[model samples]
Target: SLHNSGLSGHNIKIGIMDTGFDTSHVAFARMRSENRILTTRNFLDGGNDVMGVPGGQRRHGTEVLSVIGGFDEGNLIGTAFGASFVLAKTESLTAEIQAEEDYWVAASEWMESLGVDIISSSLGYIDWYDTTQLNGHTAIITQAADIANQLGVVVVNCAGNEGGNIHWRKVVPPADGDSVIAVGAVNTDGFVSYFSSQGPTADGRIKPDFCALGEQDRVAASDNGGYGFDNGTSFAAPLLAGGIALLLEEHPLWRISDILANLKRASSITNHPNNAQGWGIPNFVNAINMEPYSPQRSLLIITPQPARDSVVFNMIFSSASTAILTVYDLSGAKVQEWDETATEPSTVIKVWDGRNRSNDKVASGIYICVFRVGDNNIRQKLAYFSR
Candidate 1:
């Protein structure tokens, strides 16, 4: 049996974009009481109140939010209940308009400025978009999603609930965006939901890059302030989004690309992803256990510290890369330098025999070891006593 990894998305910030949310539900009582909802914005009214008036139009967003951050012990626990949130009410309950897409883009930018690490959008736009425009770069929302990704935020969007509509069964905007994560729906039995959108973007890229339970998904109800059930890719998207948050919490230094790549690699159908299930359900626990992936720099671990004669430095790189390790004395003088390279995800070990750049034995004291690889510069204090 698989065991829990104890990751709860701590210190991670997620942005939820939809109609609005009801913070009065019992599932969200803990988050409300603890002040985990960092901020909110109602794009429909240009205000900060995303909760809206009582029960006016908060059902959809409320459910979506619950799937990610709602918490009620012994009842229902959301995927990333420990994560901070910034809510954006980008849709209207009365009608679906093109302006809502603009609101989505604006709200995403706002959330980015507020330092959100992930954006989970359960809303999609198709009123003004043609089937041919389902390419990754065509729609305005899709372009904005890519830009948000480039700006360092992981964008997660639903693959749309149009699978049953043969005439229009395809992923919606933003989900079709190359950089965004498009999630599809699976049932409790792990089978694809009948309504989850199918995708192979017009550009020929398989979409709904991940899958999650959406059928009869438990959520915080907006009607009577209790628990309920809902179904759609909307809920599935947030489930996966929350899982991404947990992964981010586990590997804070990992880049967005690293997170996505490893998650896909850990999915059930990594080697042969399809339109309906994409890469299949992701095993985040397995992903967390995968080798640490850092494309830009290598992780440094200096062993046998306070050395008398020699010490070993272990460096792990995610890809073919080179790194330089330099030791400096308290007076800012170079003591020794070591250079090593690796062609893949592997460790490089280097040993130093307490010598200077001129290959002569140096006086023992305290020294600083600085490891430089790509844009990462890691420094550690080392103590050396010459024999």
Candidate 2:
């Protein structure tokens, strides 16, 4: 029933960075024919050998892609069918750190140049074949990660599968980057997976920012010619990545941070956030329905800190008179309304004091400020930390 909205990720560009993808595979044939796959690059070889040899091995990238963008029926469906994709092979069967990490960085730059809306990397680096090549304690949060975040590209990485273990249980590299959305794994029943990584990063920030279904999740298989089952934060990352494409398609102007914040707000844990679930599982429907998530326009501003008094809002609208504004409480209660009046041309600014029609101070807490401008709507957070 989640797909009932029929809001496929049409026209968005998504980059899948992982090991080689088997383009020859039937699951991806349609994508190639329709030009849904914009281009393919292999940072691993610096050549066009994107397809692995005809064996059950080296197909991890293909499987991950199928989960995120594959289109099939009587089988698993991708989160974003209409979105276009760019394939970047940054990992290999060997999973070496130096080469793979270098490949990922280059691939990320290439994706940014192509203006990709999102990058879904099912790859992670913790232990390397060469012990000397291991990323040091600081590298996990620095070099590899910091560069990706600087590009303003939404990067989603899998939290490593080291849960239920005592050593190296946290996420690594790009996932450790403050800007990246590090994903953990959970079962269909919404319980955290035994293999899902845990954290409060080395710096002590809640990690595995969110989770998705990973235990026995469905994905396209290279040999079976149909959907198959798999598990891991690796699989979970793409599901969220695909969902992000849909979110981007629906609200294109959202900055990576805005999209992330709104997702956290709409996640199952808004009422009870913790390390295991971070902000909790993302609800695509709720994400789309929420205002302040408009697909167009890049900036959102809320004013008057003590919203208990009053507040003013300023926003950039794609066109004049295309937006409607409303206010709601944390409990999803509509406390105030702003009619859809024709906004003047150019950047429009509106003002709202915290008092309702009864002209009394609003209670202290969090509030939702929604803007509905034509098909584009966005919701911003307004906080009233004190009475």
Candidate 3:
């Protein structure tokens, strides 16, 4: 059925960062037969040892890769059937720590060099062994994310599965990186999984930007035998990554940020976003059919670094029309609204006194400014700091 519909993730290349993959596995046999696999690298050992445990540790990466592009019988079908892949082993089965994060950085750099369309990782780190070595802080590792974004590669990461069980809540890096699409896990019924991490990052940005089915999902096994079912934010993330690969195939010219913005826009909870489901579950079909996103003609903050009390929003439009600006805090609660009636095509500067409509100073954190001009809407994030 995956091939019958002609949705074979074709011409798209995805870079996967995880434990080693089982190259000899059956799920990828067709791809190997067709030479669809682009390249394989092991950032962990600097060797080409990508086969998981030579036959044992292959299950995890096999399942992850299958979720993104595996093809099989009536059992399960991946979102991107035509997509090719490059495997980058960044995690070690023995230890998960800050050093793994460094390996991921190296892997991502390699992915960019290959001009991959997307980077999907089922890895996240919250509590490293050495807290001093932790790179969860926003200021530290966001640069890596920024570089990936600038290279026109969409980065998708999993929010850690630590919500109900852990004290240090929220997603891990590079999921914590503002530019990455930090994904959370939900079930077929669309309920947030109890183990899905919660967030409003340390800098106060709503994370785990979207959710996907993670519970009891079918995945390919490295045994060259059959499929296995599992649950984790790991499974949820690749479902989205697979869907994104399809979207990119359809809209090749769209920027990574535009794709991300449209995904957030087409999510199930565009209006009622929260920490558990940032923009909610992304709708792949809707994202593909939607109008092409033009970030330039929408509302944007051209910067003075972080917005102090007053900030200017550059408004761009092709036709003269009325524009409405609404500001919301990290909790998705509306704090302010400004209306500009029948404005000409030009830039409009709107200032907030760092206070809510009730004349109260809003707490220092991250806020979203949404601008609506006719049917086109744009949203931008602004950081607020208070002494």
Candidate 4:
């Protein structure tokens, strides 16, 4: 719904890991066919044809890409409608879909090689992943996704459509990865889709970190001629991925971890997400506007880039100055906020045990410190390593 905000990914590069792309799709390529795609690869066939080698392809990837980067002005528009892309044909159209976890891992590394800022994967591995490995840290693909997180590349994935079934009670692998933003599907009515997978990884972490409009979503066809309605968590995931692209466009300096955290904070629920709807739906505009990590210069100095147990900072200003010291999680939630008056040369601010406003200690991760100094908001990064 943030479409009117006028945010576009422009120079940001997003990597699409799915069945493959339809190079001919106008959603990707306009009349002159200029901004449709950038680099592509077919990991399945080991070929340069990422626009799905017809026999080796399916329209799935094309539609997925359309949900993110497709642009046709009034006719259609994706979240990052103008963003560039790197398409990886990691999935096969074979009878079994023929995609193993290794192909996905290799493609992920390839995306990293191309320096993609975000990886939007509508793919999940379930065939070979045993139920025991559904824990957040298990599964080869899950580990690979964590690697992408380590590299600062935001990873988003579908939470699978296995909800309606009794046999499969949770989201598929890779989606179970804690570091990945696993997305579920919701209808326009704000109801969880019947087929959207449920979760709670085997390790007891919330799966499908968020949900998006997925049921009967209007989608671009691979033929590039007409649009049709599609339904699945796949579509929902890309829609959010595109939103993140738009966010990254405005705050290029934002850390991926912050983005992930802010996304949860800005979601409809804001806290205590359930597996059915994850953090509920995200408000795209709120998400972008809530990124408090965007830096501005100030006399405030946050000591210890990476902090453990506590964080100390010095606020220096001409004459005595009064300011608001706030701590916000990635989702822009004010974990801790208080008014401060720096009357001396150095009015030091120290946070012991990383507790928030409620006095509950924050978990080990990244946080943003915002100093509402005078008329400007200056921000600093704080990292916590749990004891």
Candidate 5:
């Protein structure tokens, strides 16, 4: 979709977290010529060189980068070749270690400090971890990803390649993170790949929020300095991340929630998401052309602001869910609260008659109106003037 639009993720900074990279590949020649590789970090050794050992370890990272930023006329054109990049070597494919999680967390912090707008993580952790811990809040990496999301970084992670396994076939963390966009694999025909991990997190939340081409996907071959095809959810993650970069390039001020909501709204399966394919595959054309995402779409909206008698709180969400609307004074005191459920994909309107919990008229100058749904929290300012 970005091909003809002249939109190529220009000026967008994306952090790639993988084993390592080999920037010498010809596929990345254009990017190298343009100096689009902003910086690099090797969390595994605290070094600056992200190109680690010259074997299979760095190859994965190289191929992942190629899928996002590589460019070769008549050969391979990445989803966002014009975007800038920051590479981080955060894993060792040959080593089975527990500290890998810490490495990922450290890399995330470093990337955030470098002002990366998005993080494309093609790695996942499941070793020595229990299936029950697939809950978003359990894994340390998931917690770190959540923190990154709160800091306004869009984290895109692979949904793991464990679908064929019967023992434990769930998504890995930080893919389990609520705020992270976990991407699964799909074939060229847009069918779910057999290797893409399933979702429905241990906490009953949808995991792999999106899907992308992963089977036989084209990637730069680091060893041969050419292009090749790869099959894994690892490839799918970066593909989706590259598309996200294009969107962010167009909408620089959009937040994580806004991006996710728009992606869901533009996905192949808008409604009924499941563990196998969360919201299905995303279409870049549909997403970019849709209405610009705003926090009010599924967050909170205060109507009749600077009200004289009463105020209405309009809380919208993608689906039917229960939420709590609480009003707090400037002094951090609770003024009033209401609990209501939206029975459908529509607005849940709650009216307040300028009264506190005591049902008595209260004098209010400025107050904070907060509406919380699931893991999303939105706040709006409300002003009340007595009649």
Candidate 6:
């Protein structure tokens, strides 16, 4: 995804409020060495050691950080690996190892003091609350989250993983905040995970702003002292936060609200947003490139580039005759050919499976597709996915 845009989150500072982080973790070593981590704070005791007190050493915070900045080439690479960080240990483990609403609010305020551009909280509070408090403005943390947004900081929270199987099936606390970028979890095929919290806050507004791959999501595992996988909306939140950092790097002059609006507009399923997936998965490639495509205005539209097996071409024609469609390899060798008779002025959609006229599969690479429609010819190039 980083290769799809020029943004690497450079010059952006992100604040992560969670359980104690493993400062020794390799995911943060390079950044720390380069002074990427501006500072560390243990909000629990107001100290500089972000590892928290004692038994509070759960590896969850380490895992969360890995999804945003961990890097090891082919082994693992985070979405915002180039961004700076300010780790805050806001969780405690004396009893159940839970972080309270007061602690969360305090962390947000502290992050604000540092003038951080983005804040990611994979932690949620529910000790004394009931399902009815899922309203957008009820929870203390939710209200604080909104205040943070008003102060020009974008807050990213995990839409609690209590969907479908739970009795109280709604997003939690800060995730319900109107301005918070509540992130939900989805499987690889884009289906909402059964455990990802459902949206449409008690006030009837969709909670999660977007969804991302979270089930069995890969991350830098503190357990292996290397790379592994963990599943939760917790993992999803940081992944999205990293994307926001990269977007900020590109549009440094824009406000957080402007960035949010553009991202919602560039969602994979932009036209239709639902409670389960909010706007849908944000296509950062489109967001950074400003490719707000409209089916009506585009002259010729080809889709699913780097497509496997098949590709589709949608073209608008005023009048037509015999349209010759040919797919060619880089060498100008004709691979796949199609001849269609268009009798009138109409829009036509064509699908092509990667193959040659001789019934042989074409090797994976860039292919030039030429559409000779009557007297006009349209040429578009596409890429095939395999090696």
Q: lDDT of all predictions, in order shown?
A: 0.86, 0.72, 0.75, 0.78, 0.85, 0.78
Between the candidate structures 5 and 6, which one is better when assessed by lDDT?
5
TM-score (C-alpha, index-matched) for candidate 1: 0.77
lDDT of 6 by residue, 1-387 (tens): 564555668888899987778767677777778888888888777778875323426478888888898766777778898888988887765554334567778888777766678999897876666777778788888898997786567899999888865676788778998889999999989899888898788888887889988888777666556777889999999999999888778866455556778888889877888888999999887787663223222134568855787888776665655677777775568888877766776778988766678877778776667777755455555667653
Over 4 Å off, model 2 = 128-137, 140-145, 293-345, 348-387
Runs in model 5 deviating more than 4 A are 295-387
State the local distance difference test value for candidate 2.
Answer: 0.72
Off by over 4 Å in 4: 1-3, 52-56, 97-99, 291-387
Local lDDT at 7 for model 5: 89
Candidate 1 lDDT tens digits, 23-126: 87888888988899999888899879888777759999999998899889877888998899999988997898899999999998888766688999998988
Give the better candidate number (4 or 6) by TM-score: 4
TM-scores of the models, in the order given: 0.77, 0.73, 0.72, 0.74, 0.77, 0.71
Instruction: Rank all candidate structures by their TM-score, best first, as comma-separated numbers.
Output: 1, 5, 4, 2, 3, 6
lDDT of 3 by residue, 1-387 (tens): 334556667988889988878766666677788787888888888887777455556667878888877766576677775788888887888776678778888888777666577888898665543223223444234457666665557888888787876566667667777778888999889999999887877666788889998899898877766778989889899999888887777776566667888998899999889999889998877787777677446554535436676666666655678888888764568998888754566766666677789988877766667778887656655666655
Instruction: Give candidate 5's root-mean-square deviation (CA, Å).
Output: 9.8
Model 2's TM-score against the true structure: 0.73
Each model's backbone clash number: 0, 16, 5, 4, 0, 0
Poorest 10 consecutive residues of model 5 by lDDT?
290-299
Candidate 6 segments whose C-alpha is farther than 4 A from its true place: 4-6, 52-56, 93-99, 291-387
After superposing candidate 1 on the true structure, give the runs of residues whose Cα lies further than 4 Å from its correct spot. 1-4, 293-387
Error of 1 at 4 (Å): 4.6
Candidates 2 and 5, the one with greater TM-score: 5
| lDDT per residue as tens, model 5, 1-95 | 57688989998889988888999888888999999999988888887998755678888899999999999989998898899998888888778
Error of 6 at 328 (Å): 63
